[model samples]
Target: MPAIPTDAVRVADVAARIGGSVRGDAGRLVSGVASLASATISDLSYFSGNRRGIQPDKTSAGVVLCQSKHQDALPSGAVLILVPNPQSAFVDVLEWLFPRSEPTKCIDPCAHIHPTADLADDVTVGAHVVIGAGCRIASGVRIGPGCILGENISIGSDTELIARVTVMNHCEIGARCVIQPGAVIGSDGFGLINEQGRWRRVPQLGRVVIGDDVDIGANTTIDRGALDDTRIDNGAKLDNLIQVAHNVEIGAHSAIAGCAGLAGSSVVGKYCTLGGGVGLAGHLTLVDGVHITGMSMVTRSIRQPGVYSAGTPLDTNDNWHKNAARFKQLERIAHRVQALETGLNALRKNDEENL
Candidate 1:
């Protein structure tokens, strides 16, 4: 909100780009974007006029994006740019307000690329990056500093690997994907066998195949499969610190929040949303459109598409202890209740016979 605009963006220009009609001060200029609570006269904001809020009437934003139906809802304090979907239009205007810088299209002199690695002309490789043998990097791909790519990997066009990412052997990254810093792709899965009372390593023999338009967050790890490739479908999103185990298949358009984990062979169907801190047990399958709430432990496969939650609600320490104790006695209590019911039914039968 407290903007120091190197140059001002005209309200009319933004409206023209986002397909909105301006109702006030088409010539007004805003320097930056901010929330309604902190927006200044130089900042642009948005109001979802479907909801009633005092912020819309009191906000002093220089320009505002809102629906055409609520043209009269917001006070005349800010210039209104009316559109069908204000939230989506606001994002479209972000390119003009805060444009991203294009990376320099050149391989760094200090980068270590093997002779067998085939890179496109427009690819950008940062300093200290190591590209191993038989790697194929497509056009418009950007590899940030200190990244390490192993053998026979294929990164699709326009994909970006942020600084310090590690992609192991035989992985395929799709186009328009953003792999954040410290992400590990194609890491060895946790596959071990009990051999004569000793733990023996099971060689993970598969690759990780990532589809297009995926956004892998910082520090997320995806392991290689035990036999078949572990696949992440197109348009899937993964948050920071997530652990995807071996042979896991995440379907198209699925979203997973931070700190969630999937055990080996777990499959998540398309359009599913797993909340933060959710855990899926091994070999379980979640159906399409399923949503699991935060902190839930999924012990079995979800057959239907719906919002699922588990774990007991929070209570006082004493009350929780009492409830937990009663849980253990449920089987005995059921037996006693069944005995009383049987006695009452027998007495009722005898009374009917006497009558």
Candidate 2:
């Protein structure tokens, strides 16, 4: 393990680096980072929302990052780093204190690369990585251990593939993309046919095209298309365990949360937000600005832009049983109400006839 920084930075230094104002105990010493709930006297923690403000007074954190509006809520004798947006400032501070790990320039002997593969001068290939023929790996690309890149693959500059990422043939990934471990892109789509009562596999003949600045989470699988390529637009962020079927087009700046499944031929528009566990049926289109809540089942196309929810919330055991029983009798209750209305109308008609 690398030696942690022991020198405590002055609160003024943090404010100067992140362009924030300092309040209360400017000379406080902060040596490490911690969460708001478990910060110690030499650690720094941040509070951004009301939900996170419950235990600030009880925390022993030496320094606290908060917005100017939250100054009154801090405990006495604690240093306060006030910024316009505390969360953003906290991210900058964390990045400054703990930078990401960069791989050193070492080509492992066990790595295999074809003679026709064009690799840049600064690229790092880890152990057991196989780069196939006619692959072009641009500058600063890192291929981790056990990765397999098929033929005619183009990985743009500054892209990173973590361990065990498999990129099949003829796929193009743009610059600054981070593909996590166990993510298999450009695999054959799920195409099968029942020919004479026997299941036969259909060959997937297209590639997977991923755009720039995309971050794919761990264990996510994106399949190649049958004819047209499956396209993921720029700035799209996919969370872990997502399954994207063939010919799916994800627009720019869209975010899909973890465990979401999009079937084949689905078109998701730009700026759309799909919550975790959401499922989109095949061949459906979601227009731009659509926000679907968690566990929603989108069976048809959504042309209008709004927030949609489908799944029911969890209830207590007894209340859930009662509600479930009531739910089943909803049609019978509706019929009783209709019968009452009909009897009242008949009485009113008799009175009118007598008058």
Candidate 3:
């Protein structure tokens, strides 16, 4: 969907939004947001780094957002707005520049809406959307094109489901949630039982309960639990291509980056940050405020709040091979160290007795 574009606003007006003070030409026009290296004369950029080695002199931006410490690095003739936190102020400016618009109020003629479905009067359904029987869609909700909502599903007010979103049966999505394109909620969990040699599929009998202000990224899949519901708490943000397995509970305000996979029944506590490509083993519980670095493998439960990581540092292939070889001799080396310490202790005792 196209975002609502902002018309040109005075530099002073932009500065007022972030509580910043203008250094030059408060009347300059700012119509867009860009980086310092790519900003046009009508666009605003930010200097997010310290003044060290900064070259604002080469930037062609008409306006720059910076902290008060970096004000000395502003180029001549360039307008600078100094704020306490330049990065946050820059985000505020971006939101102002590219505000998201509500989808136009229209239920497309091609949509297949069930007669028993309960949709609010102001709800917008895009083309080819399928709302099953007994589904309830609340006011101000927008279901984009090709969305499929299964029977008995409940979508709350002001929530937006982008194109091709699939919410399977019995799921409940809370208000103000944003499910990005191609996301599949309430999908079957990867559960199986072995009968001799063949595997039998176990029934996934639970729903997915997503809380308010949650953001599910594109192509992410959240599986339905085997017995209890899969729960995502409020203010949690998941990045693209992540896998959240069945019975996994992500606590409030936790942020997970792209390509992270949470195994089945793993519980992540509140305010945790999972970096990209991090993998959590099944059934492990992570305490609150845990920060995991990228590409780390977490195999055990974390009982305290702290940064956790597993995996070796990157090294050259030859060095890696050498280290791998030495790793095999670790037990032998420990035995030698133990024997040396034992002999040294015995010799010291004997000398003391003789003295």
Better of 1 and 2 by TM-score: 2
lDDT tens digits, residue span 129-183, model 3: 9999999999999999999999999999999999999999999999999999999
User: How much does candidate 3 score in TM-score?
Assistant: 0.93
Deviation in Å, model 3, residue 158 alpha carbon: 0.9
**RMSD value for candidate 1:** 2.7
Query: Which rank order by lDDT, best down to worst?
Result: 1, 3, 2
Candidate 2 local lDDT, 158-201, one digit each (tens): 99998999999999999999999999999999989999999999
lDDT of 2: 0.91
lDDT of 1 by residue, 292-314 (tens): 99999999999999999999989
Q: In model 1, how large is the Cα lDDT of residue 18?
A: 92
Cα RMSD, each candidate: 2.7, 2.7, 2.6
The TM-score of candidate 1 is 0.90
How would the candidate models be sorted by TM-score, starting from the highest?
Answer: 3, 2, 1
